[model samples]
Target: MSVLPLVFTSGWASGINAYAVVLLLGVFGATGLADEVPESLQRTDVLVVAGLLFLCEAVADKIPYVDSAWDTVHTVVRPVAGAVVAALLAGTSGSLPELAAGAVGGSTALMSHLVKAGTRMAVNTSPEPFSNVGVSVAEDLGVAGVITLAVFHPVAAAVVAGSLLLLGMVILVFLASRIRRFLRRRAQRREERSLAGAGRHRPHG
Candidate 1:
């Protein structure tokens, strides 16, 4: 089968958790489970870095505002990883070109990342952190499951990934207001803290 489907699946998964996708692909390649995986991805150093980052994300993703902060930091990281991985996959597969693969992966990842970030923004509005944990766990599972399936059944995994991406986009559009509110509240908090700090440092009579 063409590697394009796996590229799409990995790109979608990367938007949710880039490290997980990279780590899993590295392992799959190292273990000889999927021959289409690029040799560069299977390197020891790559796996180590990806594994550590994945662990960090596993923890940070369950937090509330922290997850948003982490997402903010990853806004560029995830899409870039997706593009690089897709290009590598395409380079080895010999059908799809690297530039095309990179474009597809990067764009897909950016859209999915926006959806994930926006959804988390809305979810963090909840009073309790339980919902955040639940959502994070679901995302981790979804990424892992789909990526694994992509190894064995790329087309099927791509279909599932596309469906989930569409669903996430729809939910994000519906929750646009809540996400905006979340942003406003965060900004308010920062401004308040800044004012309080200024007050503390003000000259005394």
Candidate 2:
């Protein structure tokens, strides 16, 4: 009973088939799909691949400057995945439900991306490479754990994951704004100091 809803919800939210196709594309690139798997086993493959991809992404996202680059790449990929998931899930239901699923999946993906990106930016500001790597690895593990659980128990996982993604976005936005303001202030102070130093150095003419 539980497994059916979980599968249905995940499928509806992201179009498990579509997600599988995209995941294969990501792993093998464009050429890999030339030799197709039989239709029957494709869904199972996709679920496995999607779980792995999400785990990989979560880990890659913690890699300091590398993570920033990863996020930039995913800016395109994440939304597409979300759309696919939604479409897949929607196929099980009616039109209205399909649209709703797409919206939820896309929004959740976007929120997750933004929060992860912001955290990477903050990590970049830190000087300790070891600390950054450690944090990144931990984050990847946490994401993988949750996603694995979601795969096994999607309904509860979906609600909890979606809520966390939303909360993360809010926090990231607030922190990013503060970081920007601090940088701006620091720049202004440095400029003022430089100007004052120049004045002192000028001859009394």
Backbone clashes, each candidate: 0, 10
Error of 1 at 198 (Å): 0.8
What would the per-residue lDDT of candidate 2 be over residues 1-205, giving only the tens digit for each residue? Answer: 2233332333322321223334432333223432221232245566577657766755665565666677677776766666555555445434346566566666555656566667666666666667567766655444444444554465676665656656666777767864565456557868999999999999996
TM-score of 2: 0.57
> Model 2 segments beyond 4 Å from truth?
1-62, 92-96, 177-205
lDDT of 1 by residue, 83-162 (tens): 99999999999999999999989888988999999999999889999999999999999999999999999999999999
Q: Which ten-residue region of model 2 has the weakest summed lDDT?
A: 9-18
Worst 10 residues of 1 by lDDT: 1-10
For candidate 2, what is the lDDT?
A: 0.53
Following a full C-alpha superposition, what root-mean-square deviation does model 2 have from the true structure? 8.9
Residue pair clashes in candidate 2: 11-89, 12-89, 12-90, 13-85, 13-86, 14-84, 14-85, 14-86, 15-85, 15-88
List ranges where model 1 is wrong by over 4 Å: none
